[model samples]
Target chain A: MSSKTANPVMRSAAWRISLWATLAFACGTMVVFAFLHRFVASDIRQRTDAWLTGEVEVLGDVAEHTPKDALYDRVVSEVAELASNEVPNRLRSEGHSNDLVFFLQTDAQGALTLWVGAGRGEAYLDAIRRRPFKPDEPQDLPVAGSDAPYRVVALHIDDGSIIYLGLSEHDELRVLRNLRFRFFTWWLLLVMLGFVIVFYTTRRMLSHVREITEAASRIGHTELDKRVPVSARNDEVAHLARTLNHMLDRIENSVRQLHTMTDALAHDLRSPLTAIRGKLEMSLSAAAHGEQAEPIVAAIDELDRLTEFLNTSLDVAEGKADALRLSKSELDLEELLRGMADLYEPSMHEKNLRVRLTARGPVRMLADAALMHRMISNLFDNELKHLPAGCTVEFVLETAQEQAKLTVQDDGPGFSQEILPHLFERRVKGKQSSGHGLGLAFVDAVVRAHGGSVAASNRKDGGARLELVMPRGLAAENAEPRPVIIAIAGSGKP
Target chain B: MRLLLVEDELEIQTLLRNSLQEAGYEVDVAGDARHAEQLAMESAHDILIVDLGLPDRDGISLILSLREMGVSAPVLILSARRSVDDRVKGLEQGGDDYLTKPFAMAELLARLRNLLKRNTPATGEPTRLHVQDLELDLLRREATRSGQTLQLTPQEFVLLEYLCRNAGRVVTRSMILDKVWGMRIQPDTNVVDVHIYRLRGKVDGKGQPPLIRTLRGVGYVLKDR
Candidate 1:
């Protein structure tokens, strides 16, 4: 895609929606995982404490049954060793087998009297002595030599000597770590899958919207009959498309009604005008060179003027309403200007006015050739009617930034100050002018209808200047050219 | 000359019929397409003037039926529909010329005459055209008057040639614009008059009898006298 083209991913609502949904899902899953981890860790610690408490109570009972003699130590030590063996060897190697559990016996004075397993439990002795032991209760002890803490439980006998047992928390930590690792991996996969599903689903739904937009944009004024495509699915986009189609139907109907009304108006009005004009011409011919001929001629001219006014008024109104029917074709402005100048030279000469045409090259554009010709002619007619004798009218044609600019300037008395504001409006003319004042209005309408602009201003040096800028590219190339019928010389009867 | 006029409006029909008769043509009138088709099938006409807005059927359909029946007379369409598309449509569908309504009788007559003249086949292309002392060498694209070569621009020469071809007959401003300049729309200005004025100055210089005469509110006619 071009850099100037709109980036659909960034602009589409789908992108934002999917991103936010995935974030919310991830956060929700993380909270659930945290709660689950805490629950499992506490449950594992409770099981370990139960096993430590039962083992410590059994050791205290074995000591209470033994006599206070040398054999007592041996018997108690052996029983402790037997009980330690039931801890379930969690280490993978034999070298650290005994390191997982330690046993210690202390007197009523808190002096360590007996110790078994893992180097006499020297590293954990001070930690165990620092806390007062509650009978059959397990407590966590941070041993000096191990990163994992120990869970220690104590038991009291009738002689007041305490029996203590400690179990390493390394195995518990390993189980929790394994559970967390598995959950995190699964969580990551699910979040990615969720993001993909949401993004694609939303994008798929909105693609129809994009298609509708494109189809709607393609419909132009001339092709009012065309409509945006409506999809079959009963969804919001489909509803929107149907509504647009209905609107188009109403618009096309109204335009057709306008055309029918205007056509009828033309027929109704022009019929009587034709009759009156024809009758006057007949009478003028019958009374040729007589006293009655002059007024008949004058009446005929006035009728013709009235007809001109009617035509211009209708055209101006249609143009203003953006309803003017246009048959567009490629035209060269330079060539058209030159032809018009040659045609008008004699009349300008009669008024002792000079016309100069300046052009860089052929400025080609797509427009209604007939309308453009009449528009330019109206400009020349304005100059002819309003310019004083000996004033020069200059016409300049040039292409600027893909626009065809045509300027008509005359070194004459500029427009009257009062009418300057409303120059292009209908029926706004100079006091000395003798026109129906629809010329400039028609010009403005034509320019606007063609998607162009027109401006009127007085030059700083004292002259009237009219500038028209028409876009060179109009996408009406599909408009068909009217067929020309050449009269065959010998086809009809002589 | 014989002419057939088909118009729906009674007033226009009567006015056109009277004017055409006064212009020295044997005129037949019809108020609708059905009557026009009947009249056209009955007798041969030298020319036909048809109005598009008829009562029973469109005038275009009538013209088509007439042509299909081998009625080879030239047709001139007269209608109140003044759009360029309407004019082109009329001509494309068997019309020799198209004239909008509220038209001048002079313009109608000139068009009729031109159509009639066009129907007759010429023997061959002429190398030169002459009217009184003015001569146009077509091959060389040159014009001379009274043994003096006229310095005329290319456009002026073409305009003069169109006028000379219809010498002694009136040709309107629109006709000149169509034939010489090939412009389909008539400008609302006196461009033709000015061009003719300049052409007259060149053709009939100082101390020369003028051959062109202007019929006010109508057109110009170059006299052969």
Candidate 2:
């Protein structure tokens, strides 16, 4: 509740998984549709080519055997029987939409002969003449203006006797057309079905990943006890769960280590500190009562040093002891800095160090005021401990043009740049450092909690400066912000 | 001075036992809840230090279960399960104090002594939570966080109590599912969130602090603040 972390703000694993899975499913659906379309079309072409070839062969045989007049006589006689037998009954009984037949040639007077006008009209002959064809010796003429195609063959008799045969390609063309329609319908349904499956599966998978990701993110933000749920079976999701849970184990261990270390420091150091305080109190009382003034004064100074160390040690223990105990609220940073200055002024005066505080308008921030209060106070302690004699300790709190800086500088002896990087490292007591070496460590921890960065260096004018830099709004508000939300995981899976 | 400690880890418990006795507190040690339960039933001790991950039973369950059979002693929970959810869970189950482990013996003693000092009268017959006109009668196991009262199923009341007790801390998705739902549904289901929303709508009516607010980047926090 206290920390403003963006760990859970990014796209969820579930959403990512679903997105990719759905995309893959759509691509596959397209490929299958294309393949199906081409397949049905190719099949129709091959069958039509074969039917046309068959019509030519059958007509060529009749021309080779039967004479022209006999062919005409045969056509005239065969209409009733062919109607009954040659076509499907639906076409036979229904005459207008039926396959038509006819023959045409030059008459004995050299005019065109219209001999065999059995079932067809001139439209049939006109259709025969108009269709495009190659001059193969057994080429068939194409039929026109029907749901299915028809082919015609013209045979020249020996005495210039023109004989012809007409065969309807209605059935084969119908089959091909029907096949294409059916294939389209079936394939369309298949593709839709595939998409639905992909959507559901992807959504489900992504949602699973989302849950794990959320859990992992929670663990990253110091919820060390949180663990990713591992399914009893061993799969990738389960593997991820197991791995995260393993990491959580270490985190919990380290968290426990931190607490134990704090407790140990507090308990271990308390007795020695109490003994020193007791002796100093006794010495001070004895000095007031008797004439041993110098020894009492020396004892009092040593007691001050011991108490200071004890206080710092207790602070280290508290930092680790209840780091999880955070009381968060929305408060302005400007006011908080003022409060810190007021609390630390007496200590600064005791050391004869002038402390300066500055602020403009309100700078709103969400944090645990008590913790932040302690954090800045620790920084002031460090400043007082390391400042040069007669040098004022300046506490500068300023925000200009969107960037906020909090700097604590001392007039005391400053360290070289080499010791700068290690100042914030835990337990690293530098030459000009204060309070058992954890003052900067505690400051670093608090800065990190605010999602800010800390740097310690010598001032351009020969002093020690600890600067904490953060965006005017918590790094979160200043960031290219997005709502911490996502489409639930695995929503896209089939 | 003598304390019966129930913990699974030999190393941690041994360190704790040695540390407690060194700090001048007598300790009766049990590696798991079963042994501790037997020892606790038979003997007398000043206080108890319990670990949740016991071999026989969850330390919380053991404590609550013992309370059912009338074991009236202050219990101090020392666990590695250090979520606010876990802490709230231990307290809800009749634990007097909850301390996440890697704790100093002195702090644990301070907490134990504090519990020893503040002796609350046990609710012998009628154990219930009453806030304002609302009464959650544990004996009858009924409902009421505010004026709108209803008879709840046992499961529902258990869930509500956990949420109500941890009213100001962020409760994780796993916490609700693990403790309340208890591995019934697949972890992937939004049942926890769904049920929480349903419960919230029912409990926090008209206008209120939304008893449960999602913490955006974290879990759900039960805070009116």
Candidate 3:
């Protein structure tokens, strides 16, 4: 394979896989060969040794087939020329490579002493000189430093004498050498095959892991909504992908929440700062250096706005974003709305706008009284601020089927189209140009916290309309709310 | 009255010096808590104004450090953070009074007067004090203008009390909010103005003389004739 191209056979996974397979195959084959060599080959060698020993015992029998001297003349005539001299040139050793040395003995009277193989030396004759024949059993010798294993078998004849056989380990040694040579060649081929398979699998697995790792790093810098892709199969990789995506979803939510908080902070702070600078500059220009009542009025206004923004922002951040704790104290929704109307009556008169408030029956509601009061007040403030002057502002509340509906309508125009899109987006509403835009934002937040809905739209009669729908499941019956003049800060709803 | 100021920001120091000198006080400025302590101990001053977040050592403990060394001059803490917990903690740590930063010079002066009055040794009763035609009869608990009695409401009486106590000095709304109400009022309403406008009618209603002068961007003060 070319190095430039991806080839499993040349990779580490391929190499390891092939190597393991080859080892497994070679071990199994070697075990089978080991048993076969122990049983079949050893049997053949034993029988050959016995037959040779029987033949050597029959050397005494050569006297029956022919005269001893004649047999010797025939044997020498047939084999002596080939065996007596060393042949100089040949393809293989003409000598018996591992042929046994055969000895003939008959009551120590046979003429044939011992005929070793063509390559045999004097060691066989010296061994026979000490003992002419062996007993009727095979004998094993510890051939030190020899790689091949063999055994020797001795046979007893009817003449009360014995013939012995010597078997060398050359045949078994040759078989093992051939087997080893074959093993390496096949091992190399199997290793290549295994490497191809392992490399393909491990590479795919690593790519999936790498993809998830990269995804984790990207999420910190990029959009949190981005997720890691999962594998087709439902496995460990797929599980990781699902988990990573879930984590990203949570991170996205938290990031969104943080953005909202930052906007809230900017809006809340801008109010006080604006007031401070305005009052301070106004006084400086007026050249009133001491005990100016106007500064006190301006400063008081700034301080109040500053405190309100801070408290509301704190509550929202704590997730108690509900302005004013839920004053579970039973409240008369009608009375609260009436009091709100009375407070706005003077402004209504000045603006030449008539306010008609319709209150029905002691409809009590359980809610954060002050927060609800603020919510309605905010709706009223919106109409006063967003609409042009000299328009009729209507306030009405009704309880039907345990649901209370509080609606405010004005003959002036509703919110501008551009303002509608971001009305509830904290500081996104232009508080500087449009007085603390958080008033409606605060209204939205508070109403939602109390499990109510607030909707604003153009009234059918060419005016702005706001409605707050609240369920009365939480309120206790017959509890009354006291009438008090809620302070409507000139800044916003409350 | 000569005063010592321990503040880090130059703008704030300038604001303090300008307002204090305008109010006729000899002022000395210190940049750190250690220097403030040294200044307070070295010189006898009518009042001390300290700002937290000093470069060396915390300013809260500096007040305690001064008290430990027998410098009983009232130490007023002015910090940028107005958290309730921090304000309570400051008072608990031997600070005579606390005000958040970005405060008007009027507010700072008012607080300084309050602290000085609270800590000022009663060598003798201040039975008679005059601001132009206005006179407060401290022993009899009455106020008069050119020997004519003036009718004042409880709040009006209290307001006049603060103005008489620090005649010729400016007071800010924040000081009024803290001292008069004991509760921080929101900065959106004309509640303070309404009260001041009403009180003006009672104290200077006879047309004898205008005892309360309005210092725009600052606070109300009673000037001595």
Candidate 4:
């Protein structure tokens, strides 16, 4: 549910990979387009300049060979018109009479001798005169009346005059603009296509991995036999699924082995213990009123203690190994605590101790009822055994931050300083304590198995305090519900 | 009452049979599931005590088959597996009661008696229960002894009612916890002893013969002498 509600798109590896790849591709294509645009603009300018230089040279030669008369002017003008018409007309707009090129002749006195072009040649001649021009070289010059600069080439003739040929850069600029527009449109389309392709392919490839993760999450401890679905494609995801399944197989095997081992051990050990206790009881009943009866009863009590020790040891071992099996059910902690308090009230009274229970309403959680009962009983037993007379024991139960908190405090001699650090460890207890030292260890195991935490400390005011915090509604998520079957014959009250 | 016991261990089988016979019941013994089934089908019995570790087949499957064969007698399961899950499994498979192995003979007998009592239906509903001079008005939830009103809390009343129901029979602490307080696991404390002590003080006044008797290390019995 959390995975569904979180920002899944940004978190997904597929989306991140595709977005980065698209960015890289877009940048690469833009750089290439910029280089190509620069090359094309430069190439067009060079061709225009070459054409202007050749025309200017030929016109200068024609002026030098002709006599200084009206026929000479007519000959030069005709040659210039023919040359201007020879320029490329591929991108030229129709119904435009000007050839987009101009021809001019200037005498030594800096006066315009002849002009042949679309616009008035005075602007071009003035623009050329403003900056000293090198003969036989084409340079860009901006005239006063034109929006586009002209590429002009000048040549010196034998009659102390200069011939100028200027070609308008309007067509070159238009060609470059068209190239850029088309390139940008295509570039945008390609970039979008690249993004979609990368995103789609990456998502398709990673869907199997997501499926495996979902399936694996569904397999709880009880359902270890279930395995994730492996894709048929022999890819990395499939390999990962196979590895996980193999690990599960080993785990299930070891768990099965542990169960078998504990079961066999319990059977082998408890059978003999049962027989001995039975014999002792038979003898005790027969010698109902003699000293023999007392000894037999004591032996039976010792046997019972031995049995209790065995059960607790096995339980602690399993719990420490993280293999404790839990049968979960919904229970009210407040009710359970109250019941425990009532059960212990009489015993506490006999010891001249006072007890109080503080709780607010009900705090419900899912947990193993039997384990919870034993865990709480162990706590009470400890207090009953250790606390001095006239001491008070307090139990407080409440829910905080979606966790059930239970605190048990007593006004008695706290734990010995030496054993305080290792209190929860197995076989750790005070020097004067007469227990097998597994009571607190068992409690710690139960709490840890339930995914909770427990702490034991001495209050500064001379008492012991134990606190436990367990997450609510966690066991239900991990344990599958078992069908309940009530025996029909014993359903009624006796 | 006639009873059937199926156990694989020879020593336990002998000990239990001797104990049950001494308690004045005719018990039939079997060493395995096959023999137990044969004994059960041959004659009707009032109760069956089954050990879960059977040589031939699991005790759970045996119980299921017996139930299917129309053996409606209540079953008491004896087992070495002490986990709650195992206990629940045994009961779910049609066992009426469960006792873990290495148990006290008194506990086993108490369970047997309790199971037998469950199988027999009471004649009818009675609004009041009378034992000696003590009177319980079930309808009003009140108690009186020797014509004098007794003060009892609601929980104490329930506990007295349970004791009165099985007046002559011994009721163990675990039984009282289960029946009166609805607790399954027995806490290691003398809560039962203290409660019984208080109840005895109230039920038998200074001159009255003590009605509640304590069997040290076993349980309690209420007898009208």
Candidate 5:
């Protein structure tokens, strides 16, 4: 799991998608909470104002209708009850909260007469005293000892006294703070839920895509029968699986058809060739010392040459078509070259040719052993067939950087000027050659298939030179060097 | 020696029948797998030459049937399928040897003769082999001509052994390549000729009559006059 998250792209993609989605959802939730906050705050303010206005209206009506003695008696009792921390008799009848409200009234003499409130109310009364009260509009005034601001409503009563109704904003603010707290808690939960949802959906979708990629990587030439499993979901991923399977089917069919056709063609062409060669041999043996014997023998040789040409031609064609089935394995270059040399030693002797093999230790490479043998054999055959008597063929195997280089050089007339550049081309042969001119072409194909290159050129010292370089197939670079051993005197003797 | 030649092509059947019979073998020809199977069961032949592409059934299956029927004649597969896979499958399915089509007559004859030599029961057999003045010890891997030990390389020993086995018969270069180097066919090279030349030097010493003769364009033949 730690290794998986170490990839920056995978980590960032998941984080980015989840984070952006959570942020958008959180912003939308905040907008909704803000709207509810505004509505509740306004409703609380309106109820507080209505309660204060009702109290003031009752006091003004009592002042107008009742005798001075009765109204004064009621006002004195209300102030006494408010001062004693009890609800006022007149305000209590309407279920008003006078806990944080201040009621200040004056008599007709324009003197401060009634300032009745206590505790938090006393702070509100002092705030009213510091500022001149307006009768038409409500004013907000800060309490002297509290962070709450008061909503003060002042009125001119018929008793020639002004009345002020101040309601503290502390309760409303506390209610709003509590509502905001609850909203934030819910928003946090919402953001977390949004993140998990986005992460899960994205991961599940990408896992299906990963399955397709893995299946594709496993498909090769020999494993054409394997197909990506199609899902039951009628979505885009399943559709892609179906399309890939269809394409594989087409490829496998074409390959099978090609193989069958080539096999049939080869069998058909060789049957008559075999019969003809057989007839020629019988005729040559039965000729009984006549002119017919010479031509019959010649025809038999020609047939043998034709059969060889056909086999090499088919190999070249198959190599070009990418249809050659090679079983690749690790091979020792020195050992393989030695085997070829031993096999050809006798032939080289008959041509008066000297064969030399030079190698720097056992150079290893990955290749198809059979094809590589044929390639080397063809190279030797080319030299022996073309070079005159008394020539030397040198095979050198060594390493150049990470590549294993094999150079086949001969001390004979170099490739003719016209054919030097086209030495490896198909059907390019010397004038006196009996080959179908596909030898070097086969060598080139085999080398290229092994991720190597083959080149032919005329040596400046008057000979044809061919070089084949292939990548060394071992991880020798990372191997630790052998430690040097120092012989201690008499260590074993002691 | 009695040989069974199973081939579908009429011309190939006629040619092989004539050549094999002329080489002093009693040859029987079969045009298809059914006929070949019938012949294999009835005749106690020394060798069976079967072609891969037969009309009724493939040659590999026919060989398997023959083996199942307890007919122990050495079977040689002749096929135009030159792929290594076909060759391996042929050998694996009870075939003693495999020769692709359009082959040299000398190679076929040499291989057939060699197979017969292998199957022949020995009576009072010795580890040493002799051909006129030449002698070879099978165990020590040494050769001597007229009591003079001949220094020979491992390859020369194998080559000479093959030539000595098919003493008076023509063994083609392809046959030598197949037997000595274990190669199927190598064209346009004098590797076999050169080896034969070197081996002749040591085998035919001073004042010794020439024993190995070149058939020229055909192959080599060893005999004692």
Candidate 6:
């Protein structure tokens, strides 16, 4: 699961989508809550404004018709009645009970004559006196030591007297605060839900894309017959799998055709070549000695060369068809090369070429022993065929990190610049080369099939150098041996 | 020695018959697997040379059937299917040896002679091998020439033994590599020549007739001449 989430694309996509979705959801919730907050708040303020205005009008009537004493009595009785009725309601609900509407009367002067609410009105009266009030608009009186403000209203009649009415908006403010708190809580929940939904959906969709990527990574020549598994759903990913499967089918068909044609050519061409060579050889043996038999022997030699050329062509074709079957084993590198050097010692001496093998000790590697021998032998063959007399051929073996490296070098005319780049390619032979050019190419194929690599270049000082590097171990360790047997022409047994 | 040769191609059959006859062996030819089986069953031929490709059946099955019929003569299978698996399969089915198509006649004759030598009676046969004054004791794994014991490495001993067995006949480098070294692929180098040169130095010595003579580009022949 960690590996799945570690994919950079999927991780970033999931995070980006979740973050944007949560932000968008939070913004939308804020907008809706802000609108509701304003609507509820305004309605509460309007009701309080209407009730305060009516109290001021009733006080105005008392101040005009009665004397100052009667107005005072009316104000006092009204304050007491409101306090008694508000007590029960405040006790009934645990809300703001600071709704004590205050009434005050002034006798021909803008002075404080009455006070109400929780605190004394001396400070309230001073705040009201200091501020100017418009006759048509209600005034907001700030209570000195509280966080809530009050709505103040005033009324006057023809009695040369003034009346002021004040209503504390603490209850309405508390109601609006509660509404905001509820809205914020719900908005937080919605944002969390948005994040989860977005992340999950994005991750699920991208996982399907990863399946296609993994399938593509496994496609190669050896696995041309394999196809990406398709899901049952008729989705984009399934369609891609189907398309890739169709492509694989086409590739496998072509590979099969190439293999069949190669086998046929091996049979059709080699059989007749065999017959011709046999007859020529018989004639050479039966012919009279000296000049007459020379031509027959020469013809037979040419036929042998032709047969070798055909076999090389078949090897190249087989390489292309992926038919080079390998039987792997744990082989001692020192012994294998020693055998090769021993095999080539005679030819090396014929050219007066000094062959030196430099190896520390036995280097064991998991490889196909026969193929490895042939690969090295082909290299030596190249050295013998191209290098001049008195030149030296060196075989160096060592362990570098986890790989076994073998370098074959010869102090000879290095590869021409024209053929250096295409050295390992089939038929990429040098001008002095008499071979069919499949020697090095076959070597390259054998090395690659063993999961190793081969390279050719010119040495700095002089000489052509070819290097073969193979891993020292296999992924399956020294797993069970395959039952496939490789029968060489005269090899007795393993 | 009488030989039975089975081949579908007329030219190859005719050529092999003439070559074997000239080599001083009586040869009988068969154009197909059926005729070859009939001849092999009726006559006591010293050797059988059968081709894998036949009109009636595969030569491998033919050889297998011959063995099943209690014909114990050494069989050499010839075929165009030179893949290791095919050759191994042919040998696994009771073939004494296998030679691929487009082979050298000399190599074929040498292999046939080797097979025939093995099939001959071993009674009264000395445990030692000799080519003129040179002698190799098979039981003791030692070699001596002119009453002087020569120090020989294991590889050199094997090479000398092969040359002694095929004395007076040419043995190609490939044939020696195959039989002595047990190698199927021939190296581009003249490894056989090098070993033979080493053996000649020890065996021929000073004031000795050269026992092993190079046959130019063909091979080496060991003879007291």
Estimate TM-scores for all models.
0.77, 0.50, 0.41, 0.84, 0.65, 0.69
- Score candidate 5 by TM-score against the native: 0.65
Ranking by TM-score: 4, 1, 6, 5, 2, 3
lDDT tens per residue, model 2, A412-476: 67766676778766677766453567777777766665556788888788888878976544443
Q: On lDDT, who's better, 3 or 5?
A: 5
* lDDT per residue as tens, model 5, B1-225: 889999998988888898888889899899998998788888788898998889899888888788889888897788887565654454645438777887878888877865776677756657888999889998999998888889998878988988887788888888787777765546566677877888888888778889998775678899955
Give one digit per residue, the lDDT tens place, for model 3 in A1-494: 23546454455454465567667766776687578667755665565456444543444344234444646545632332332232111114435533423333333453334344434434443444454335655554323333433344555555544444445545545655566668668766765565566666765776687788887766542345678888898988889888888877876777567645654564446434534543554457455445565655566556656656765554444333332234345677777766555444445444455666665456777776646665666665556555555666666676666677877776776666677666665664533246655666777677666667778776665776677787775534543344332332222221
Please give, as one word, the docking class of candidate 6: acceptable
> Which candidate, 1 or 5, would have the higher DockQ against the true structure?
1
Quality of candidate 6 docking, DockQ:
0.40
Native-referenced DockQ of model 5:
0.50
Model 4 spans with C-alpha error above 4 angstroms: A1-6, A45-49, A52-176, A289-292, A349-360, A386-421, A455-467, A474-494, B83-95, B189-191, B197-208
What DockQ does each candidate score versus the true complex, computed on alpha carbons? 0.61, 0.02, 0.06, 0.59, 0.50, 0.40
Query: Residue A342, candidate 4: how far off, in angstroms?
Result: 2.1
- Compared with the true structure, what per-residue lDDT tens digits does model 2 show for residues B106-212? 34655676577655554454377644344577766778766667645455577677665455544555455445643211121133554566566666667644565
Maximum-lDDT candidate:
4
**Among these predicted structures, which one has the highest TM-score?**
4
lDDT of 6 by residue, A178-249 (tens): 778887797778788878888888777666667776777566555666778788889877888899889888
Which regions of candidate 2 are displaced past 4 Å?
A1-51, A64-177, A215-243, A288-332, A343-370, A381-416, A427-437, A449-494, B1-225
**RMSD in Å for all candidates:** 8.1, 20.0, 21.0, 6.5, 9.9, 8.1
Give the residue spans of candidate 5 off by over 4 A.
A1-219, A223-245, A287-294, A327-334, A346-370, A385-424, A429-434, A448-494, B41-46, B67-72, B84-95, B113-127, B138-141
Chain B TM-score, candidates in order: 0.88, 0.49, 0.74, 0.89, 0.83, 0.83
| Candidate 5, A1-494: lDDT as tens digits | 23564466446566678778888888888888889888988887777666666666665565555565746756644743443243222233334355456666665554556665546344555566788876746767887776778777777876577766666676667777878888888788878888889977766666676688788756655467799878789999899989999998997787667667767777888899988888777666667746767777678777777777777777676666555555677887767777678877667666677787877666777777778877888988988789898888888887766788899998899889888787777999888887778999888877776667888888987998999998775654432333222111111111
Instruction: Mark the 10 consecutive residues where model 1 chain B has the least summed lDDT.
Output: B86-95
